[model samples]
Target: MHFPTLATPFIFGATALAASLTQVSNYNNNAKAKPGMWVYKPDTVKSDALVIAIHSCQSSAQKYFANSKIPWHQGSDRKGYITVWPSSTTECWDVSSKASLSHDGGGDSNAIANMIKYAITTYKTDPKKVYVTGGSSGGDKDADELFGMMSNVLAATYPDLITAVSLYSGVPAGCFVSSSGASAAWNNTCSGGQSKASGEAWGNVVRNMYPGYTGSRPRMQFWHGSVDGTLSPNNYQETVKQWTNVFNVSTTPTSSKPDTPEKNYRTDDFGSNVEGIWAVGVGHSVPSHLDVSEAWFGL
Candidate 1:
């Protein structure tokens, strides 16, 4: 082979590097990995509406995508909406502290919050339409450690970023009343004790979490199975009361839908939209559709 006098090895090396980078992109494209928080978009196309759906304990973002967990799937793709399912550092969100919201910034909550920001920045998600939801452990605390549960702490932090949150079989904020966390201690006070929280106790918790002047707090939507064995039914009703007090809505639901595809549901008219879904005959799972949540979020 003959080389041109002007040919240079450095030029050839640069071309090789570019080709390698191109190969990596092609491989990822074929692999179908979505950007930010290990999310899954209907298409790598575009979306303004975003759903930050966290998986239950021992689950991953891939599982949410595989099972079509939230309503952001199906017809949502065409509507310019996308859903993100992020894996916790170790299957749990550290919502105990506001700083935990950013990924690698601190606990799981920090990272998850960072993920939402990523979706918003990367996909240009609408701040108003932004929403959050989780399954059994996803919504509540992980039994393993009473992990920094989402519903318990969301009201306390990130009020500006997250518009609303949906909880399925979730735990209330005060379950961890002590500085030191232990499963046995939490289980004794919280496990199966489904008493509605004291209006003062929980209301104060939310108010303290969002201590500042005035602005609309994030709305709340709760769903729990009446027949859930792992979680107390009392907890379900109590959850409703907690949010009611936080939102300053009447304890009773204004709109109650008694018959769905599988279970009965209802929603109270809180100024900022706080609703509860009592699944008459379901378990620790997503009893209704994500579209139902869209309606709840007023999207």
Candidate 2:
């Protein structure tokens, strides 16, 4: 089943600063998928940063940008960062493919990496300041084929290319691969949240994405609804486990707070680099937190 757009209507009025939007088809020459793109450039470049916003399955880049109420472009207008939205050609990212799971392997992830490279070179944006965010399938792809997008996994596949990540209702990278060393469209173990492992073991999975790399890993922020049924709340728990292990931080949060943007939505800060936010009573379709996410990205 195709996921809903799951975005609030754009409510804010036009601001003083505005962004120019452009569409492109040939950003990468050797990418497995020739995904389309929607590029948003702020008139006044301030931070020299870049953000790549991914779309959900069966969704187009234009639809994701037009339907979502996220103020990322507005943030770009004010902060002077470039924003990019890429569409998946196969309706969903190839998270199940062996080529996609490996670094520099050709697939939608490589297309996205090429998009980032295109933006950095064409727009002269800072490579170190690149940030990524997505929702639902756009946030992650599962082995069960329940949903497919690779925002969170993209960072793990190319840690050096991404600086930070904010994922909503997504699963852990490689959560869909079966023990037989093959892609399985469905994996009840992981989707049900029964897949448990130490931080070290989970970290090993991400480290293997780019073998022999010791550079700084991208900081991550995970967001999930308390009652999301499609992906299961357990996916959130497992995601916390995977990333906390990747960051080498204690599973126990260093600090906790309520009334974040509203009551009942609690924010858990695991350490300086990892965080998880639980939206009480919310379901699988958690709207993107535009302002809060921008703040986390330091825009």
Candidate 3:
């Protein structure tokens, strides 16, 4: 399916690219093929800082574009950042096989690598300021596929390409010990059970990978709804704990305010390095007041 272009309240560059499926000669022809679409928006004013990518679960790039309320509309637009969103081949990211690894050839990671090259070559995006964000399943998988296993590819492909990542309502991919692992991880305790093993495994990978990086650790931000039901908010909390412990960061107050009488919240920074937030009354869905696209691009 194609992303539809709609009229925007602000004047910015926007374009939609069609979804395509490519064949990998090395992989089995019998292997399942992944297809995805991409949308690109360039900053209005030239920007040295650019956020290159954002994604969400089971949704088209077009949906993200439509939902984003760019700051330009509010008359407080920052210098434009390049925004790119890629659709998943399926409702969930393929996180099971070696092909799913970010370093795998012709996988989702490769797609992202290609997109970044295109962005810099075509849009004149800054290499140092590229960022990424996502929610739920997409957010989780992206952590590993983009940053964990594919770190080499990312660094090699765009040496200065990635600056930070913001994940909302999701744990790192491969963290769950079982389908039910979310329950234990969120609670900040692990019990012997046959839940999703992915979260646990992914957690170990993050512990090992992030700290040893020769480059600066990318800034990380995590936000979760306190009352999240589909995926426990606790899972997100545990993930934050893991990040803080590994990065050796401490918490400090950033913002504390109410969304409503029933739904207020606060944000805190971990040693001014990482950000973690809990939205008290928010649900499994995206918060109503935040613009997904703008948040992704840091616009």
Candidate 4:
């Protein structure tokens, strides 16, 4: 499937801030898919201090940003952060090949890198504060894939581009059940000896490729819902453990329940400034509006 172009009609209301939302057709000539980004530029802003590149699951860049309520104009008005939301080929991200299931080999990652370059070249964005984050499918599996791709290209194109990542409701790509019983409980899709072995191998590959990137691994904030059925909270825990073990960093995860209808769980490094939250009753949706606008930003 080819991504739709951004026509004047597509630019409605706040979407006008978008500089462009075009399809990138050159991912892989052989691939039968097209991916793109919903590029937003804050109006009346001359420069920006940060540029956030967002990755979405099945949803298009427009849908993701619209739903997430990431203010495009706010970047320019407040602190100056340009936000770009990139759409993946399939509803799910294909991490093994570092591309989308649409076979747009490297197209997704390339789009993000290209967008960042464009932002810097055009908007005078600070190269140092580039950050990445995703939720659900984008957050869970696609996040790692995007990171791996970024690690490979950022060094070459923008040597100074190092990004911090925050993942929500997703596990690192290479996690699986270890025992058959556990596998069966997980519906055997992620079980059996082969699944275990492959998962371990894949995990190790990710570790080696992205290691505990000192100064490279951006401060991470992971959030998951304890009751999430799509991706269990255990997956989030395992991912944190793996990352900490690999990085050899000491962190104390603090737990809490804020006084909202939905319970909130959070942890952080008291010293290093890495924090995460697991909303007790939330499902596969993005963090609550109150959390993102108030709690996350306030913190």
Candidate 5:
């Protein structure tokens, strides 16, 4: 999946890049990951939205900022929003933990929630406009390392803290979890895309995260590469089934077409609040779709 360069080219020079990232030392006290936080504030304040961008395994926040094709900093500057990046001190995010899967449960998810609150208060960002996006390890389902755990776990554990989330190759919230509240370090069942369940069953997993929350559920977007052996495309299909049932929308997409002129880069709009993108020959981390994300986020 190729993420086309946006019509607005990236113009941030070395000085801007140098001035962009600021280290945030205090966000959470109990996170197992003990993640390091980094913030990017746009030069012009056009929007009050905040975006949390999580990094993949074997990657640091600084590396993600410098190398991710998603253009997070560029989007922050152009859209006049704040972007937060969290670097897990551990080998990976604590997505495969019982605590991380539960709301207010002390783990990486709680740490991320604290980070969001910190950013919102410190930056005066709109609490209602908070969003999240991530890719592989951080955003996907991998057999050896549990790739897609971050976005799924965070969104499930703290729906109220986020307005929406875009996941690249992510599985359902409880995909890495077993029935006994135990988490798998590597769940081949889910990673192979065999973690199938009824839409209601999967939806219940998300609802169980909060138990009794009555507020609106955050919207979601999914991106998957059809040929991605690392995290099979079946996970994406299951994700669509889960959210569609959560929204009480039909399983059938209202609209389906090529996202770009590219033949296999198809998009299926399930409803106003849910969308899925399928890339034919793409692999592990689906191509960055910041342009579509900006519009979805209303940035």
Candidate 6:
């Protein structure tokens, strides 16, 4: 595949991108907001929307931000966005840890929410443009926990703040059942393989996140390789179904191909809220066209 040119989003003011990159940490809540790498283009600003790029299992924030081989850093420095890469306390997101299953959620997931809080207050990030996404397990960490359980689980738990969410090679909530059980919410460890749930079943999971949800729910996107080995590619379909159901999107996609092609695409609107893209021949990796992923967020 060819490397993406990545010149889509209009460039912002110089103040935004003045610093090519910097390290910021929330000392007030140091435990929650891990020392994350902040990236900006040459002309970006504080009001620009933020992309919280989460890492895959056994990966670090530094690797995605500065890794020479991966183009993640390259597209990350494009024109219209500011990027944040926060490290996980454990090798993977706390998805498998027993503590992650807790009612208040494990440290890793809660910390990510805190990171979002820090970004909004400190960087003046656009709340409506804020997006959360990751590669592999990082994509949808808390989806496998339970149905309408109201656990303050992963970053998705704060849908009240996030405008949109996208996942790559990930599963939906309750996709896997934990071995430790409800009493041991602290344990992230799980015992089952992927537990398939229909779109309606998982939609109920998202609705349960907020005790009394009223406003617009987070928009959703799903991108995965047809040949993903780390996680089943079919899971993307389930994730799309869940998000679409949550947003009340059409059962069949509004549009598909070239614009949202069988490979390398951006799907038609799912009621102006949800979309899915597929990358053929790609594996358990981040979509090569980081620019397209950003565009999915309407950035």
**Top-TM-score candidate index:** 5
TM-score of 2: 0.85
For residue 40, model 4's alpha carbon misses the true position, in angstroms, by: 0.8
Q: How far is candidate 6 from the true structure (C-alpha RMSD, Å)?
A: 8.2
Worst 10-residue lDDT window for candidate 1 reads 19-28
Q: How many angstroms is residue 244 displaced in model 3 relative to the true structure, after the best TM-score fit?
A: 1.1
Q: After superposition, which runs of candidate 6 have C-alpha atoms over 4 Å from their true positions?
A: 1-21, 30-47, 69-76, 96-106, 135-155, 181-194, 258-269
Candidate 2: residue 202 lDDT (0-100): 75
Residue 100 of model 6, lDDT score? 42
Structural RMSD, model 4: 9.8
TM-scores for every predicted model: 0.72, 0.85, 0.62, 0.61, 0.87, 0.73
Measured with C-alpha atoms, the lDDT of residue 6 in candidate 6 is 40
* Model 4 C-alpha lDDT versus the unseen true structure: 0.44
Candidate of highest lDDT: 5
By lDDT rank, best first, the candidates go: 5, 2, 1, 6, 3, 4
Lowest lDDT 10-mer window, candidate 4? 183-192
lDDT at position 247, candidate 1: 75
Per-residue CA lDDT of model 4 for 147-247, tens digit only, reads 32232223222223545555555554444222332210222232121233333443354454434434444445566666665555555555555445434
lDDT of each: 0.56, 0.73, 0.45, 0.44, 0.78, 0.55
Q: How far off is residue 294 in model 4, in Å? A: 9.5
Candidate 2 local lDDT, residue 97:
63
Better of 2 and 6 by lDDT: 2
**Candidates 2 and 6: which is better by TM-score?**
2
Superposition error at 202 for model 4 (Å): 9.1
lDDT of 5 by residue, 159-189 (tens): 8899998877778888877555543366778
Clashes of each: 10, 5, 18, 2, 5, 20
User: Which segments of candidate 3 are over 4 A away from where they belong?
Assistant: 1-37, 68-78, 102-106, 135-160, 176-203, 207-212, 250-263, 288-299
